[model samples]
Target: MPVRPLSPELAEKARNELNETDENKMVDSLQHLKDWLAKQPYLKARTDDQWLAAFLRGCKFSLERTKQKIDLFYTLKKTAPELTPLKYKDPKFSEILDLGVSIVLPKTSNPAEPRILLMRPGLYDPNKYSLGDVMSVGAVIQNIMLMDDDNFVVAGGISIIDLQGCTMAHFAQMNPMLMKKMTVAFQEAAPVRMKGVHYLNTPPGFETIFNFIKGFLNEKNKKRLYVHNTDFESLYKYLPKEVLPTEYGGNAGTAREFTENTKKKILEYSAWLDEEHLYGTEESKRPGKPKTAEELFGVEGSFRQLQKVIMIRELSPDLAHIAKTELNEDPKQTPEDIKHLREWIMKQTHLKARTDHQWLVAMLRGCKFSLERVKEKLDLYYTLRTTSPEVTLRLKPTQPTFINFLRLGTCIILPKATTGLHPRVILIRAGRYDPEKNSVADIMCILYYMVQILVMEDDSATVIGTKIVVDYEGTTLNHLVQANVTLLRKIVAVSQDSLPLRLKGSHHLNVPSGIETIFKLVSAFISEKAKQRLKIHKSADELFEHIPKDVMPPEYGGNGATVAENIEYWITKIREYKSWMEVEERLGTDESRRLGSLPSDEAGDKGSFRQLNID
Candidate 1:
């Protein structure tokens, strides 16, 4: 039986479709598109509508599917047109520029020759060219277009390293369009896994696999595509840099060497680019040098002080009233008279709510330092002095805010002043407070309340340096993650009792119970002044003489012990589980063992056991 000759016009049409050099021109024309659509029986079901309607529906669907591919092809042509021009010229991987398939040629080889379309499936870089695979694809198409017949064998190859790490699989997942295009182009394209390339750390696994793709493509335009898993550069180094014309170098042997070198350089440049582009990693920290004054005190500290000064001056009238009418100090400057003056600055402006340093600095500039000078001297004087105020004033502190940072979930920010040594931190939070009863309306508000206790202290770190932390918990419309470090610290002073109890029943009341438990512990702290008064009888008398016996600490009643001693005695009894430390130590080993065996949870829960259970 003899083979039938294809009609000249049909042959020319096939050639145009398979061998045309321009990708844009290669897009099937509208008539050709209609013809192709007429063939798909499943899709043709929807073609019962009028021609225009069917055409519109098909156009919409096809446009959506082909948009990315068309864009990618054109982008490749624009960026690397030189590479596109030579894909079908005796298509073989003799050199780098001739490395990949030229879109101009038919995607497959003829039945007569063993052709392979090598591709390492990967996520598209929008429009990337694999010289090896493209050349292989181009060569196969070239052979087929110029072939005497239609049937041909084609196969793909990927690097063993890529296979090992699942790179091809990941690529397929990211770029399904590329996979679809390649699959639709070659239904009978066989998969050939070759463990032939060793990309051992020269370039990446992908580059080496690419080079092998070229190697397999240029192989005698045979019907069978042979893929080798090997690094092309390593193979390039081992094999002749220049393959002769008889050796598949074709007519442009000299240009091939230049092409190969260019490919290697491209690989290197791509790698360099990859290293330069960083995303989630931390930047390298420079070694330490001398610290600037701002760094030592913290840039935030100055702005914070500036903010305080502003708030203080804004309420100067009230502060002056307190200073003059209450403390008997002149409002105007006279350093001596201004000494030991103390006043609390209430925060009401939304400006104070912002944590940005620039915003704070700008806000600080608006403060009249000249007017605050007297206030400033008084402030500093009060900080260093031991004199107590005649009247305690209530200052409203901002609520603590929590943020979800990447590393930590819902962390309260520790103030900069509270860092770097033995530092002290004040946490602040806000919750609804019942003014009538001077008690928290909600139990959970205590978290904010406890945080507020730390935030409200006037010059809290008088005798010690500790870290200050603030967290804010409020019903924000934004579902805030616990990542923002700056905003988290602002609301630390907020009382836990303020937390919203969305749940019903005992859970709602439990929130406030928890708050009281914490407050009980906090109110137990002895201030430095109180501690000092516990020493020397005269000092104790000076401190206690102003207050009634009922109000005075226990030692002032002549308990044959100072207040500090009495506190220590109580602490010892509570801690040792005996009236005296000596008595606790005298207990036999069995008694000590029993005490040590108590469950930790049970011990702590005892503090609020009744309240927690009742709630």
Candidate 2:
């Protein structure tokens, strides 16, 4: 765990640049700062002398700056809860460290040599760990570095971020709020001077992520940002091979070796990390009111503010006219009618919904503002929510299983809405489905979430219906065997009878040899009229004939964006609706008032095999 010490020649050079000609004067400055901190009742116990010296050096022996930095550092640790209670021994921490996603190179004291920190975000597994976990490790690493008087504070460090294999799945795991806190902690609180940030092998559409990080950076650090754009030669100019690890074509040992050594070094400093946990700011000691998380990190006028952004687009005049004509209602009466429906539904004995105007409007549009149909569907929707706990309760989008399922890129919503087609195109990659890991209920929950959001976005689209394209290239017999028949029946029943959606069309593409079995299971729940809309295609060409390639992903010879890009887009949208989903979680039907309905306790005793055919 012993790190390489700085060479004498480099030490002298750095000391000269820092204007630390008098060693005794620097020592006195640090002592004065510690003494001042000890007298402050508002602050916690003084940190160790080594940490004090590191801060002194980081601020170039400036006592005032060092004191200011120390206060902010501890204050951030207190305000940002994620930074405290350091869990270096946690299994998730070990897993992330073992992946070698982020590694600090061996220490070098040479002011000329860059203290390089390498980060390979692609090494992160979205299914195993979240971005918050990654940032937690970062806080620990930064703490360890802060304790190092020679390596980090003396010469500073530059980062090389490799985003070669980064995908939407990885980006989706990033928590913006946590990211903002981490950025602020590093830039304002920590003593490390970030010399430069180099992004190597930058992927497409990285601007979205880059801009996000840039928002938190100060003007000075913004100038230090350099995107290599797949150019390693440019990176080599700043970070020579001799200083980099073998993985980056440098003479240093393999990244794995450096990773293991650094991890062991961190483990050895467990006591220090534990002590650091108790050193956060005591907000109660503040002279004035302490800042909230939103007050500190929430950006004003940023698109990231979900509450401010209007997610539901206004219905066009043509779509509004279509709804009026189809439902036999006056165009101007739709708003009042929806309000009435909302009030009436809230009064119903069986259904329990907060019944917001937006939700009511979606239902009205789904049934083309037909009051009777809206009432029926509303009753059935709440009933399903109440009974189907397996699907509704356990299916959280934040769950690892759901995240991995989305990462499979099996279920994709096409970016472009097809002309003259009211329903949005949803492409399902059946081959990617692993029945062993996932049940039909899981799939039903995901579909329900997606359709619910889509319906709310556009009422016209819900009325017209959703188009589904199932790609069965990889479907297997094992998948069919593992499919839960009971869940599948419930899914179909919910879609056909309860959900506010039109059965536009179902296209089966790259139909597998065993598709007949899958088709039979799916078709059993729908009517003959719905079955007539099912189209089976042996190849992409045949599938394209029914559903134009223009509205499909680029991978399928379409003009729209790639499936990965589409996934990224939807992931952002899904995150924005997290608040709405939380409200929906409480919604259900009170079945006690229904005629012949069993009591809540006896409901489970009744046969679970009662199936509602969608047709």
Per-residue CA lDDT of candidate 1, range 1-615, in tens? 222333454334334433322223223443444464455332211111122222222123244333323223323333223333443222333232343212121122222222222222221121343423443444333323222222121112212122322233233232222322332222212112121332322211233233323332323322332223334444344223233121222232433353354344434444432432221111122123322323422334643442222111111354344334423434243222212222112121111122211212111221221234333322222211111111011111121111111012121212223222222322222232222323221222222222222222211221122232222234121222221222111121111111111101010111222344333343233223322332212343543333223323342342233334433432322232112222212221122222222111111123221222232
Rate residue 608 of model 1 by lDDT.
25
Give the residue spans of candidate 2 off by over 4 A: 1-7, 84-86, 107-111, 287-295, 298-615
Q: Candidate 1: deviation at residue 606, Å?
A: 22
- Score candidate 1 by lDDT: 0.26
Q: How many backbone clashes does candidate 1 have?
A: 86
Q: In candidate 1, what residue range of length 10 has the lowest lDDT sum?
A: 500-509
**Position 156, candidate 2: lDDT:** 76
The candidate that wins on TM-score is 2
Model 2 C-alpha lDDT versus the unseen true structure? 0.69
* Cα lDDT, all candidates: 0.26, 0.69
TM-score of each: 0.17, 0.50
Task: Give the TM-score (vs. native) of candidate 2.
Answer: 0.50
